[model samples]
Each structure stands twice: as structure tokens, then as C-alpha cells.
Target: MTEFANPGVGTFAAWDYVVFASIFVISSGIGVFFAIKERKNASSRAFLVGGRQMVCGPVALSLTASFMSAVTVLGCPSEVYCHGASFILFCLAFSFVIIFTAEIFLPVFYRSGITSTYEYLELRFNRVVRVAATIIYILQTILYTGVVVYAPALALNQVTGFNLWGSVFATGIVCTFYCTLGGLKAVVWTDAFQMVVMLLGFLTVLIQGTIELGGRGNMWKIAWNGQRLNIFDFAVDPLRRHTFWTLTVGGTFTWLGIYGVNQSTIQRCISCKSERHAKIALYLNLLGLWVIIVCAVFSGLVMYAFYINCDPWTAGFISTSDQLMPYFVMEILGHLPGLPGLFVACAFSGTLSTVAASINALATVTYEDFVKQCFPNVSDKMSTWISKSLCIVFGIACTSMAVAASLMGGIIQAALSIHGMCGGPMLGLFSLGILFPSANWIGAIGGLAFGVTLSFWPAIGGFIYPASASKTLPLHLSTNGCLPLNISDLLSTQLLNFTSQERERSILAENWYSLSYLYYSPLGCLGSLITGLLISRISGPKHTTIVRPTLIRPVSDLFCFWTDKGRKDNKEKTPSDNDRIIRASAEKELNDVCIQESRKIPSIYIPEQCTHINVLCVKETYF
Candidate 1:
């Protein structure tokens, strides 16, 4: 049996609501500003990619804000507090990973001049592979949307008794309204603003918590003495969670999946004014994300120091570990006017930024990949409107999904694992297309299918039958400080009600499924790579020169023989010296068609989409 201190250990004051509501007003106002200011820019390109003229600073901040969603603000602290500062390793891993991205993947993307990263897939493999990757990205984004929205709402519900579904809907609707109205620029600008507020809230808590704890030195001393600094563990065990190797090695694949091929990241990286600006944005983004990670983890350490003698779970202050941070806020900052509101607003800002970015990316992908593919000649106004409409639809759909998923109780907690299961395969598929020139469409498709299958089998099993981490992380907390409060009710026995009749389901998962979630990326990536290579050999390696060498990453051809321009493959069907022109294109002025059409057949091909040809002869005349 357990006794809770109260339903909500921290209640909001009168000014808290006002402070929280202001973030919504300003965010929505920015959307209105951009909607009216850029009303003339109605093309889908302008709307979705900001005409590729966006400044790097806000775009960089937006990139940081999007990934540092409510999950990072809330979950990372919980992670650090429970498992120690091992979460810091993820930030460091992402740093090196970003450098890899900038050096290897970023150059290829910028050179391609693509609206969607999926477009690269088509240029490299074919339409089928591109469409498959797009669908997977969309699915990954939607499942993740529920998590961002639901986390802040859950936090509010636990701390202030705010309505969970109400907050979820409000958060989703606000994100949709702005994302659909202002498009990419609005989302970026709004994210930049919200990021500042989030920093303010974090700083306030950190500074105030430190003041209460005496000083920074004391803050670290308490954390060190409490054994919450276990960050240097270099254990080589796969089953153990949060080891140095697991984080850096697995984290490499995870961040690679996120920054290399993710549509939202791709759009922001390329939306900058130039290659220099784009690279600068990514570097700045690295700094911003690293700051948030440090703040969140340090805040967790601060929270631990405050309740070191009286663990909140044992003291009955919070029902679950997730509530630790929010409850700590109430205990320390509850009395201060508008401070609680500021913190809540910070969480809300995080949720809105993440959700809005995903919604905008969803609309972008839909317009580029689906709508344009179906109706290529559609007018710009109609296409842009359709993109906006998609923003709304995706927004509402995500909100509803979040609400519906709430009914699943604790099962919704596994959503991250579910989303992560896709990361490995998606990363693998893209890496194959970029680094390995020998991979074909058959291999790409089959490899993706096989990679996802490999990831989910163990991921899902571990969720259902969670391995006890007790031996790995023995309870290092006590409630001795609360003994005088008379509120302690320990669960001395964890349900002896079995009466020896249930047989305890004597099965355990010590096999492959028991592998740590951190290794999911490596498993999927390795599986996809090996399987794709084997399958491609059967499909005859996509015929060397069919794809331009620029589509492949730099230096990739050094070891890859197929990507060399001089490769003569039997699969290529080249025409002889007397080969006739299979296709010709001529453009004359704005009409994009050659004049004198009646004279000598003009040699103009009126097609934006065409099949492979033996040779192309183009003629152009402007008058």
C-alpha cells in the first residue's frame, strides 16, 4: 500500500495562468504577423521552405527547439536523476555525429537541390524506395507527436490539476493554427522566441534551487555524495542500460537517423541563405541543443540535492518518478508569483515548437511527395492551400491520436521505443543509398522491411516483459527525513495476494529481446546494410552510370568501384554511334517551349517527368 501526500503537491497561484497564457498569445501573434506579411508568397516552396531565404540564427534555434521538446525538458531530468548523468553522453555523441553530418551527409543534400530528402531517394534508387521512406518518416513523426503533446499535459495535470485532454487539444490546436497560417518562417521565428522563454524558466529554477542548496559547489557535492554522477561507466555489456559505449555507439546511429535523413532537420538545414549559412546554422544548433541537455540534466541533479534525504517516491510526495521535477518546482517555487506559470509556459513552449515543426514538415512532405506526384500541373495557390489544409489535418489527427492513446494508460509510455524502432531501418536505408552505390531498389525496399522487422521483434518483447533493472541500479535512496512527518506507508510486501496459486509465470526474457533499447539502432542499421548488399547482388547492382556520381557522398567512390564514372556495366543499354535522339527538349522564354514549332519539328519535349533515354538533344531560341 502507498500513501500520496496530495493529488497535486504543487498548486498554481493566480498569476501562473496569466503567465502561461501569454506564451500562447505571442506564439499565435507571430503566426498572424508572418501570415499577413508574406501573404503574397503563396507558393508551396515559399510556404514550406521559406523561399530558402531564412536567416540561419532563428533557423538554428528552431532546429534546437524542435528536438528539445517537452520530452527533453521533462524526461531528460528524470532520466539523469534515475540513471545518473549518463544522459550527458548522448549530447556529446550528438556533437561528434553533427560533425559527421556536416562533413559527409550535409554536402550531398545541399548539392542535390531537393525540397525533400526523399527526393534524394528517387534520384538514387527509384520512386518506390522514396515513397517507402516518406511513409516511414510520416509515421515516425505522428507517433512522436503524441509524446510531445502528452508529456506537457501530463506534467500540468500532475502539478496544477490542469485538464490533461484540454491542454493536449489546446497545444495541438495552437501549433496547427500557427503552422498552417505562417508556414515555415512562422514556425522558426516562434520557436526562437519560445526557446528564450524556456531558457528563462530553466535558469530561474536552477539559480533558485542552487541558492537554496547553498552554492554551486554544494550542489555538486550533494550530487556526488548521492551517487548520481555515474557517467563514466565503460562496461561492455549490452544488457546493461546507459553505458558509455551504448550511448556513444548507439547514439551515433540515432543522431545520424535524426539529422541525416529526417525531413524537419533537412528542411531547416537547407532553408538557410547559402551553404555557409546552412553549415553555420547546424553548428549553432549543436550548441543550443547541448545547452538544453546540460540544463535539464543539471536541474535533475538540483532536484536530487533538494530531496536527497527524503526521496519523493518514498516520502509520498509524488506518485511516479516523472512527477519528481514538477513536484520539486511546487515545493521550491510555488510561493513565488508567476514563477510556476513561467515553468509551465516553458514546458508548453517546448510542446508547441516540437508539434508545430512536425506538422509543417508533414505538410511539406505531403505537398512535395504526394500532391505534386498526383497533380503535377496544379496551380501554386491551390498547392499551397492544400499544404496548409494538410497542416490542419495532421494537427487534428495528432491531437486525436494523443487523446485516444491516453486511454491506454501506462502503455503510452512505450511510444518512444516504438518510434525508435523505425530509426535504425530509416538510417540504414538512406546510408545504403548514399554510401553504397551497388545497392538497388529491390535491396533498398527489402532491406528496409528486414531492418524494421529486426528492430521491433526485441523492442516490443522487452516492453511487454521488462527485465528488472534492480540489480543494475539498486535503490540508493532513503525516506529517513520524512519519518517525523507520519506520512510514510511503505509497501513492505508487493502483493502477497498470489497465495502461491499464480505460479509466478516462471518465464523470463534473458535472451536477445532483453537487449538494451540503446542497441536498437545498430541492430537495425547493420541488419539493413548486410541484407541490402546480399539482396542487391541478386538484383544486379542498379547499373553503374544510371545515376550521376554527385548523388553519392564524397570520397565514397574511393572504395566503391561501381560509383566510378569509368565503370562499364553490361546492365547499361547504351546506343551505338548511329543512335537516334530518344528525347529532345527546347525552351523559348517564359513559355518554356521552343518557338518555330512548325519548323523542322522544333526538337522540343514538353515534359518535366520523363523516362531514361539513349541520348538527349535540346534546342533553345529566345526572341
Candidate 2:
């Protein structure tokens, strides 16, 4: 490892340490102030959802930070390093999903008047589906948070010489403190600060790397000639790693789990002041992610250029590919005035921000899904306390998992694979709730079980089916690990690389960019949608009216017909239909009671779906 440099205690510059320390202290300071403010408004709903008054700027920035975690900063660079420019093109596939979400799901969620996004499951299908989706989210959050927690600490340990576990706990501890105290408000505010520091630190490294590598032109020339910049390989091979089809499809599915179903992203959108403001937040967030992703991918290209002949992983400078970016930063930029400290702090900030956001979302799910529904009489104060307590516990659990991640090499691949495995099923469950109106409780539950079981296969062992099983069916693995990378390369060379057309076909066949990450969203979404529909059809439609489908427009529109017609049919004076008379009598009694008690309660502020004119005004102010 190049005779590990001993940064002597006396030689350690005060200014450099101070620069990194300031970023952490300043970020925590913002979180602490907000935590104090949020504690004052300790209503259960307010603590979890920020009283639904969050403006666009904070929401946009926080969402950006939440979305761009250590995964984007570290894993993406590794993806580009291993696969090349095709990973960069993968980001574009998600832009359309973001657009669809802004127009389709955002409005429906706002109108539904629920705090947690999983509430849509209860309102649409049944409590079982709601519980199923909530559990999947909690499971995914823990795994995802563990990765975000582990990767950056590994990087920090490489750069700053801190204990691996110590760095993970230290980062998790600060995030837990403010997140537990301040709630969503604190997480969002702190994320805004973290996002700024993260970008500045990365941009510093990128510019420095460019300068050290001669310039942008030199970097690209080397990358292009070495086949690192190739994005298109028009071969129709299923075993290929990154094809245009896989990139678009897999990338879209992967992001849908993050932005569409994950509570971390949903929490930000729900906190916005109005529906239009939420869409604006989402739009601005997509734009920011585009910029951040390009920068991250470019960072990888620069790393490739810097170490083309002497690849760090192959040369044994670093133990794994994920360490490539960290080593590159420390090797070239470590000697700069304060740049090393800035990048190290940024790396930790990415981990901390994501863990904090995930912890907060987990707490919200616990309170809303399990506590409130299970124990309907808990007081607001106690409920808020439970939420805070859960955050503390989950934070500790995630820290333990992060420490464990060190022993398991290929941190990026492990983290991403875990996400795909856990997140794919969750996305499927949500799709069933939003897309299929007739998805009864039985069907929903069955689909959940099936999806969860099916997604775990690739993680345990590579693929189970025959090599040429499905036509044009790209080989996929849920977890990204070194074992699979070695397997894929070996198999491709010895078996699949034989054709005169195949070896000279395209570099994409050799690179890891074969199946783009975008397809994960559609695969998961449609997979669950079909599963739920088939199950519901087999169950033969339950007699009772299912919960209202209020999250997505099409499902809600379809179910509204049955619910409305049933109400109208019963309202008619038809004594011949004895069932109708009983339903009408029950409705009359409920309406009378509702009228008698209407004047006693105060109304809460809830944002409503707006008209085009109001939406325009909201976009102007929010954006």
C-alpha cells in the first residue's frame, strides 16, 4: 500500500483540521438549532411531517442530499471505474421517471391527506398491504442506511486515519442526535448544509484531479482510447453487463424505489407547503441530481485517466475497487492546503446525511404504521417520544451493520445489491397498491411474499436458470460484489467471448455497463402490478368495498365508480331490495351524528391540489 504515509502529529496543520472540523460543527449546529425549534412544536404529526409547511428550497436541497448519498458519490464512481461512461447515460433514464412522478403521484399524495406514503396502501388496498409495504421500507432503510453509513466511513478511515467503526459511529451519532431531537425539520435543514459542503468538496477534488492529470482534454483522450468513454455497444446479448435496454430499464426501476416509494424521498415532498410546491421541489431536485451525477461520473473518468496503466486495485495500492476514488483523492490532492480535509469531511457528510434521513423515515413509519394503527389510544406526547427513541435504537443498529460492512469487501456492490434486493420488493408492493384497484388483501399479501422471495435469488447465488434461458433477457444480480464481478468476467471470456462477431463486437460486452440500473424500477413496478392483478383475479373480488384508491389517479378513478354507484343505488327508496334499505338506514344515522358534532373541532392546515394558475404562482415562488 505504498508505505502508508505517516502524517506526524506535530506536522498536522491546524488550519486543515480546522477546515474539516468546521464543516461538521457548522452542520451539527444548524441541526441543533432546528431540533430546539422543532421540539417546541412537538405534535406527533408536526414532528414527523414538519407541519406540512416546508417550502421548496429546503425540500429541494434536502431531497437532493437524501438522494445523493455516499452511494452516488462512491458507488457511482466505482460503477464508472468498472463499467465506464455507460453508467453516466444510466442517469438520464431516471429523468423521465421523475417527470412522471411529479405529474402523477405527487398530486395524488398531496390530495390523499396522509403523512407517511404507506398510508396510501391502507387507503387503497387494505391494512395488510400497508403493513407489508411498511415492513419492506423499514427493511430497505436499514440495509440502505447501513451502506451509506459503511462506505463513507471506509473512505474516511482511508483518508483521515480514523478507526473504521469509530468513524461510522461518530457519523451515525451526530445524525441521530439532531434527527431524534428535531425530527424531519432538523434532517432537512442539516441536509441543506451538508449538500453544499459535499458539492464544494467534490468539485475541489475534480478540478484538482483535472489539473494533476494535465487537463480535461488529456483526461478524455486517454479515457476514450482505453475504451472507458464508450457508451454504445449494439450487441443483443443477454449475458452482457450493460446494454442500452438494461441501462434505461434497470436505472429507472432503481430510482423509482428511491424517489417514488422510499419514505426518505416521500417525506421531503409531503413536507412542502402545497402540491404545486412539492412538484417544484421534485423538479428542482431532479435538476440538481443531474448535475451531481454528472460530476460524480466525471470524477470516475478522471480517476481512470489518472491511473490507466497503474490501476490502483490491480496494482494492489488499494484492497478493493471502491477504494479507488478515495486513494485517488488522497494521493493527488492530499497534500493541498485544506482540500484533503474538505473531501474527507464531505465523504462523511454524505454518509451522515443519508443515515439521518433514513433513521427519521424509519421512525415515522414505526409511529404511523405500527404504533398509531395498532394502539389507537396512545397520547401525542408519548407517540413523539417513541418515535425519537426508535431513531436512537435504529441508529445504533445501523452503526453495528456499518462496522460489519468493513469485513465484507466491495462495500459499494454489497450496498447496492442489498438495496436492489430489499428495494425491488418494496417497489413492487407499492406498485400493486397504486396501479391495481381490484387487488384485494389476499392478492396484495401474496404478491408481497412472491416478490420478496423472487428478488432474493440473485443475491444468494448468481442466476439459477440456464445461460440462454430467456431471449434477450439480460443477466442481473441484485447485490454488487467482487465475487460476481470475477464470475462475470471469467464466464464472459471463457464461454461467451468465442464468436468472431462477439470479441470484436463492442467493448460494452467486456465492460460492466451491460444492464443499466434504470430497468430495476419498471421491472419491479410492473412485476408487482402483474402479480397483484393476477392474484386478485384468482381471489374472485371480495364482496366488501376495499379502501379508496387515493394515491394514483387511474386506480382511484376506476374504484370511485363502484363506491359511488353503490352509494347511489342504496340511496334510492327500494324496499324490494332489503340490503339497500339496511345500508341507507345506516348511512342516515351516521350523517345525523356527523352533523350534530361538526361544530366542536378545529381544522388543521392541509395543502390542496391547485389549479393551473395557482400552480404557476407556486412554481414561481417555490422554484
Candidate 3:
């Protein structure tokens, strides 16, 4: 507790640097190991997809690390600090997200055996739809990587007094070095390693902090008294941020965009050794995400208890709420050897995993969609180099985008905003192709355009005219616990301005910019679906005769309720028994070892996650 040189700041120690440096060395070492091991292998597939024989456990860890990012580590706590514990609802929504993605999306992508999920667009519709979705994915990944890279850098810089750009480059360089060296395998393995680092680093702080603030009962009592324990709001108003409805409904759509369709996770899913392994990977990922979210939310409660009376920003101790976690870590964990460094490493581990995942995915889409099309005759030797080069190029681009992210307000909101605005449209595009037989390329492109416009209007408006939110704290923040930093006058003014801030938020709350960000993904997904349907019908949909049955997921097989009746009907429409056998044998040509060709009868495995979400058995027939 007395570790800080001053009341609010702590410095990094020699052991801290030693612990932090190990993360980079080990991460980069993985890349070097894979590069040497596979030197004789002469194809880009090895680089891009681990030869499609990647271990399922690492893929699951990579998926969790890729999606959680530093944003969840840093932002979730800050969110709880300012907005209460409503984020718990958002984490809970992943239960449904994983079920839908694992059962519906994973099967189709694994069966198609495409490197990029966008490639499915061309198979289902046309190249135009594929290109459009690819471009949107690229934009979303770029923006998100920027925010992820910047978040931890900002946190470390605020506490350590290190140059922010220095922290940014350190993260980008190490990530790029590993990713470019070993490709997807390196990225996956490093992500697995970092996942352990993240859990150990973050949880250490939570445990130590909870100890500093007394026992769990006393800690909960403090949070309850301060209103940080508020987790439910049944309000249906879309503009009211973080209500139960908004968190649950809006979070479901957001997770769908991330898990169901995003390239980062999809690449990992499709690269696994078998379909069963991929499904298992996804289930494990959901549990990892849930752990991170719970830790972060409780960490936020811990932060609020410590600063409830002091009001860090009002007292001029920190510039933003995001800094609170880092500052607290420095103060409480700095005295102990390696603890602060562990926390810093934890934050940056999230950045490295996320940035590397994005770099790999960006390279994947570029190689599969653009390079292959533009140069049809490129040699495997040269193409492998091209993919590696693309990783370096994107790694730098993401690093540079961190500058732009600096001005994008809170990292979590900005990252998710990009996800919803761009990812939602792409998710819709994929959903349209996978769900509806009548969908055409023209309609998909039109729908994507509409969805983007609908989602971005509020995002852009909010960027220009940021909305103010009224205070909802049951206990008012006090400066009584704060020591004089010699700015008594400024603190007094901030206290007075609090009411005016709330007033302004109320006025802006009526405008489009004030629309709760949670609604963005749903708006885009639904907009795309409706518009695509309208345009498709108007232009004339192709007959089901032209659509491949494999591309469209059987809806009845997805849910028990739908399957009990739907499977019987689908059987009537399915090809005769002999035709199905012939087609199944032909599809096994992909790889006997890489893909599973099983078509077992329905088996009911009611997972412990939820009651309604059933894990359907892989159908023996391709209905």
C-alpha cells in the first residue's frame, strides 16, 4: 500500500522489466520454432492454416484471446466504474452466441473448407458479394486492432511514464515479428501462451486488491452502498444505455458478429483438425470469455470501492476512468517483485494476441481473395512469402491506426462500434447467404450497403457530437478522502459542473447521437436482412433448384423444436439415398485426415450451458 512514490502513481522495477521481456521472447520464440520445423514444407497453406491439422485446444485459447483483447481487460472495469455491473448481462449473452455459432456457423464453414469465410460468399452468391464483405471485414479489423493496440499502451503510459508510442511500437513489433515468422500457427500458439499470462496477470491484481479492501463480504457491501452493484435495468428504451434488454438483445447481435462471422475466429475454427474439435474449441472459448468478463466486472467494483470517496478525475489524480485500473495496479502491486510487471504484461498480452490474430486474418483474406485472383500462376514458394509480407504490412498499418484510436474516446465502445457498424453488415451478408436460398449477390451487396449506412449514422454523429450521460449513482462521489494536489479551485469547479454535465446529456439523449451503442449491431443485421429480402424479391430470386443445399443450413436441424418436424420434411426434399451417398463420397476428397465426413443420427446432448440451446447431431443425410 505504501509502494507509490506519490499518492496516485507507481514506477516499474528491474524485476518488472525482466518479467515483461520474457513474454516477448517466448512469443517470438514460438514463431521461430514453427518456422524452422516447417522449413521443408513448401506451401502457403502451412503458413496460413497450420496445414489444417492444428490442435483444437490452442485454437480455442486463441479464439478467446483474439476476441477479448485489452479492451475487455481495461475497458470492462472502467465500464463498471462508470456504468455499474450491467456488463454481466453482456457476458451472459455469450451462452446463446456460442450455441448458435457452434451449431450453425461452424458446421457450414468447416464443411465448405474455405480459408476465408468471405469465400463462402462467392460460392453462395457471387464474387461481388464476397469482395464487398471482404472489404468491410478488412476495415473493421483494422479499426479494432488499432483500438486494441492503443488501449494497453495508454494504460501503461499513464502509470509508468513510458512514452506511449514506445509502448505501441514494442507491442506491434513483437506481435509482427512472431506473426510474420510462423504465420497462423505462431499466432495461435502465442495466443494460447498469452491467455495463461492474461489470466494470471489480471486475476492476481483482483485477488490482491480484494485482500487490500478487506474480505468479499465487506467489498460487496461497499460496492452495494456505492451503486456499483446495480446489474439489472428492465427498461426497453433503446436510447437508455445498458438496460437488461439492451445488454442482452444488443449483446447477442454483437457476439454474433464477432463469433458467427468475424474472420479472426472463423479462420481458427476452420483450421482445426476436425469439426468436433472446432465445436469443442468454441465451447471452451465461451468459458474463457466468461471468466475474463467476471474478473473484469469485479475488478471494476474493487476500483470503485477504493476511489468512491476520492473521485479520481474530479480530484485530478487521473485523466480518464480507463487509467484507474492501471494506476491502482501500480499503487498496490508495485512493492511486490514482478506483480506490477505481470499486470502490465497481462494488458499487453491481450494487445499482442488480438493484433497478431488480426494480422493473420488480414493476410488470409488478402491472399485468398485478392492475390490468388490477381495472379493465378504464382508459385507456392512466392505465395508463402507474399502472405508473410502481407502480415508485416498489416501489422504496421494496425500500429499506425493506434494514433487514430487515441482520439476515439473509450477503447471498448469505439472497438465495438466498429464491430457493429462493419461487422454487423458482414454478419448479415453471411447470414443471408447461409439462411436463405433465394438470396442473390445483388441483394446481398445492396443489403450490406444499407446495413452500413444504418449502423454508421449514429456512430458518426456521436463522434462529432458526443452524447453526455446523466449520473445514476445512488451514492454521490466525494472529495473528502482526496488529499490536496494543490488544485483545490479546479476540483471545486468540477464538482459544480457535474450537474451541468447531466443536463447536457439529457438534451443530447433525445438526438440520434444519443442512441445507445448496444443497438447498433441489431440495427445493421435486421436492416440488411429486410432490405436484402426486399431487393431480392423485387429483382427476382433464383430458384431453389440453383442453390446448393449444403450452403444453406437446415433450420430444422438447428433446433430440437424445428428438427422434430422439420427433419422429416427435409428428408422428403433431400436427394434419394443413393444420390446422397455419391455426393458424400465426392466431398471427402478435401482431406481424409483434415475433415470429418461423419453423418450420424441425431443425438441429444443438453449442454450444461443452457436448456433451450440443443447441440444437434450431424445429420447422416445432406438434407
lDDT of 1 by residue, 1-623 (tens): 43534434558878998999999999999999999998998898889989889878998899889888777777777767766887788887888878877766776676667778888888787889899989988888887787778866876687679998899999998999999999999999999999998899899899899999999999899889878887898989888766899888877877677777788888988787676788888889999988998999999999888878778766666655766777778778988989988988888888899899999998888788888999989898998899999999999988876855553223223444644588789888888777665577888899999998898887877766555544234236666675455333343332233223224333446556667777787788788877986788676622322334445542223332322332332122322223212222312331232232323323222222211221121212110
Cα lDDT, model 2, residue 330: 74
TM-score of each: 0.86, 0.79, 0.87
Candidate 2 lDDT (Cα, whole model)?
0.67
Backbone collision tally, model 3: 0
lDDT of 3 by residue, 148-219 (tens): 988778877877887899989999999999888898889999999999999998789889988888878877
Error of 3 at 65 (Å): 1.0
> lDDT by residue for model 2 over 1-623, one digit each (tens)?
12322222212256667887786687678767876776667677788888889999988889888868877777778777767777776567669768867765666666677778887777666787788788887877786677788877776566457678777777888888888878888888888888998899789878999999899999999878867777876665534546676666666776777777778888788888777788899988888888788888899889877766555464334666677677777777766767777777777777778888888888888888988888888887888888889889888877777755665445555555566666777777776655544456677777777776655643443221212213222122111222212233433543453443344534433332233233333445566667766877676644223233234444333332325543344222212213311355554544443334322211100012223343233223312
Q: What total of clashing residue pairs does each candidate reach? A: 0, 24, 0
Candidate 1: list runs displaced more than 4 Å: 1-10, 404-416, 469-475, 483-492, 495-508, 542-545, 554-623
Q: Point out the worst 10-residue segment of candidate 3 by lDDT.
A: 601-610
Computed on alpha carbons, the lDDT of every model, listed in order, comes to: 0.75, 0.67, 0.78
Candidate 1, residue 373: CA error in Å?
A: 0.5
The full ranking of all candidates by lDDT, starting with the best, is 3, 1, 2
Error of 1 at 36 (Å): 0.5
